[model samples]
Target: MKKEKEIKPPIITDIQAIFDRARQAAIRSVDFERVMMYWQIGRRIIEEEQGGEQRAIYGERLIPYISEQLMPTLGSIFSTRNLIYIRQFYRTFPIANALRSQLSWTHYRSLSAISSIEKREFYLSETIKNNWTARQMERQINSHLFERLLSSTDKETLLSVARNEKQPADPKDIVKDPMILEFLGLKPESSYYEKDLETALITHLQEFMLELGNGYSFVARQKRIHLDGDDFFIDLVFYNRLLQCFVIVELKTHKLTHQDIGQLQMYVNYYDRIEKLPHEMPTVGILLCLEKNDTVVKFSLPENANIFASKYQLYLPTADQLQSELQKELSKQNVQ
Candidate 1:
């Protein structure tokens, strides 16, 4: 008899990819179930506490007693602190139907910690739209991203865009000034070259893009442009899908200068005239420097120029620091 043909399994990672995806979906389902369970627990706790009264009866001790009772069977997840969080979660989002299954318990916990309704809603919408992890949401909240954006754009427009009601109309709607790059691992006091900064940004490109806000994708780095026998290399190039434009970023390890602005402007002009498609919007230039003289930037560029100078911080600013800076900017705008 002829020898039976031998069969070998296919060599490909697609099977691994499928398994990874299934695992992710399963994890997400389990997380959502945990969220729902916590919500139900919160509701039940609230009902028992209220007992038809405006305030909970012995509210101070009730959580501890319940935690002591549940800990034996339910594990430490029902500890007093967590039980309090669970209770607050329901109060924050009273309507069970309003809870998004896409958000896990951790996400809801971070969101419920927010005191402002509008801020919470903005973060919720953005988390779902951007598919941000719980850690990312926490970072945004910690960085006062909502307040920072509000300083640049109107409240209604900012919220509407986050909610997908409308697209961002201007770069200011998305781009953040004083971008917190604490993730770059660069010390503010240490001296570094522009090339060093650029390399660091490239290394942490994912985090950098998140700092850039929405609708951006990396295009090129050190993009060479030849004009009239002169060769110019742009530091970094990105495309913003929402703005339909090329974003040219020029890194300055020192304070910005008028010449730096001029250089970025030339790059923006070149991209607009030479590389931009007919359907594309005008190119935008961003000067990411350690410091900027807003007065100089104002005078250097044309009134309608799609150019902006933004300061970059090696460390995250405190809430008070951000608020103070925002107030100063608002004051300048008001004066202008």
Candidate 2:
């Protein structure tokens, strides 16, 4: 028999990719120049207002006068309200060398609404790390993700991770206690089967991945496995790049049980033993239920197991509510 020649795949040029990169570069350059221009305007306005020899002459009417003179020349962007924003930009970021070029002016505009310096820094760092769009950044900030994450961790780890100084070592380090899914259009009282819920998640996979957090990509849904004439299916599957592991997700519309944990553990075991590469870490299983018993969670899994039981909520909670609930949980953990 003649030896067969190996067929190689064709190399395709992604002209769209090149175009997108060029587009992104152009947008970034324009955004950077716009930001610096505002910064310079603010600087000149402030310096001329305060440092001029006639310092006390126009203390009150200076801003209005500047707006009147600059608006006709600069267009609607230099309105008094935006000039205030520009002044705030200069005040917040005094050093030109330290401007975050990855972020667009829209992102900075939303971030400027944040009053706390520490929280602003955290959001800024995460925006850069996650490459979140302005809308996504605003949504995260509005969702109080920082507070929710801090609820699960101590302040130091929160700052360290936010600053990109440390990576999350455990799933719990990044997992929110009750993942929110208001975007899925499911109501808390809505009666839906597990398949229906999973379908909703798949339909809104992009938003689902966002809710999952940084570096999560969908792998499969209802993944099938067969062994000894038995057919098994996992509801949802994802790979977490940051964790370098397969994250098996099992969704339940009702309250969780030890049996659910056992089932998920079996799936995790199958992945670790058969599916995961030798270089990859053990598979991590997430049992996402509508409700769960903390005591049951503690008793069901081994202390060192990578599996976790987390609850899911249909609606977004108020910042105050999440903060208070997180504080109580932290206090309870400390007591334990």
Candidate 3:
């Protein structure tokens, strides 16, 4: 018998990409349907309980009763805890048209827990603008990212940036101080070399970029620049599309000094003069140290210099700790 002709798969460019895009679209569609279903369920529950009045008659028992009845069929997702979240999801966003299709149910659940409307709105707008995943959104909330931004940036400007009404004009608006490096899996008590810390940051570069705020793309590590006979290497180099500038980051494991500031300033000047294109903005330098003296930082750079010194922490700060820090910052600003 003649051997059967072997069939081959057709050559298709980006076949994997095609499959990934299709799967993602399917997931998004299903998630959107689930969101709408939950919203409608919540609306029905509210309408039945209220019975055309502003206040509900059933009180707390209504949700439990509904959950107890529906959970067996709908599974654990309709549990009392989740039903409450679903109810809040509807209440939080009363207008169906106001709901963003981009956000998943998980995103809404986390967002509903926020009581402050301004804070909620800020996160909502930012999540959509940044395309943050549910986990990233939760991490930002846990880290008090909103409060951190508020501490450094004007409230109106921050909100305007979130709303896409204005771009960040200054590095302080995006570059986080006391940068959180918890994702690096480093010990807070142990000492680390500058190279070690740089390695950790490079390993967790995605999380690092997220912590860096927005529009940052990694350029190089240990970026070498030759000056006359001397050679200097920057720990990390990044470009911020929003700021339209090269960002030079120097890692200092010890407390920052005037000399460290001068080194970074020189790097910034080199980039501005030689590396930076005419159309690009001036290079900005940041000194990341275990500790920074604001007074030292102030005196080290000129008033108009594009240089800053910020502290880094291995762990995420508690809300109380962040609040205290913000209060201290505000007090200093008021005094100034």
The prediction achieving the highest lDDT against the true structure is 1
User: 124 in model 2: Cα distance from truth in Å?
Assistant: 6.3
lDDT (tens digit, per residue) of candidate 3 on 198-298 = 99999988888877767899999999888789988989999999989999889999999999999999899889998999999888888989998999899
**Worst ten-residue run, lDDT, model 1?**
52-61
How do the predictions measure up, each by TM-score?
Answer: 0.61, 0.62, 0.62
| Model 1 segments more than 4 A misplaced | 1-33, 36-103, 109-144, 147-157, 319-336
The TM-score obtained by model 2 is 0.62
The per-prediction CA RMSD against the true structure, in angstroms, equals 10.7, 10.1, 10.8
Q: State in Å the error of residue 271, model 3.
A: 0.9
What is the per-residue lDDT of model 2 for residues 1-336, given as tens digits with 9 covering 90 to 100? Answer: 998987554433466667889999999999988988888987877787777676444576677777898799978887888888887777777788988889888887787777767678879998898788888788677556776565545666755554556887887666656787888898777789998899999998988887777678889999999978999999999998888999999999889999999999999999999999988878989998999998998899999888988898788766676667666766979999
- Sorting all predicted structures by lDDT, with the top scorer first, yields 1, 3, 2
Q: Give per-residue lDDT, candidate 2, residue 314.
A: 84
Q: Name the TM-score of candidate 1.
A: 0.61
Better of 1 and 3 by lDDT: 1
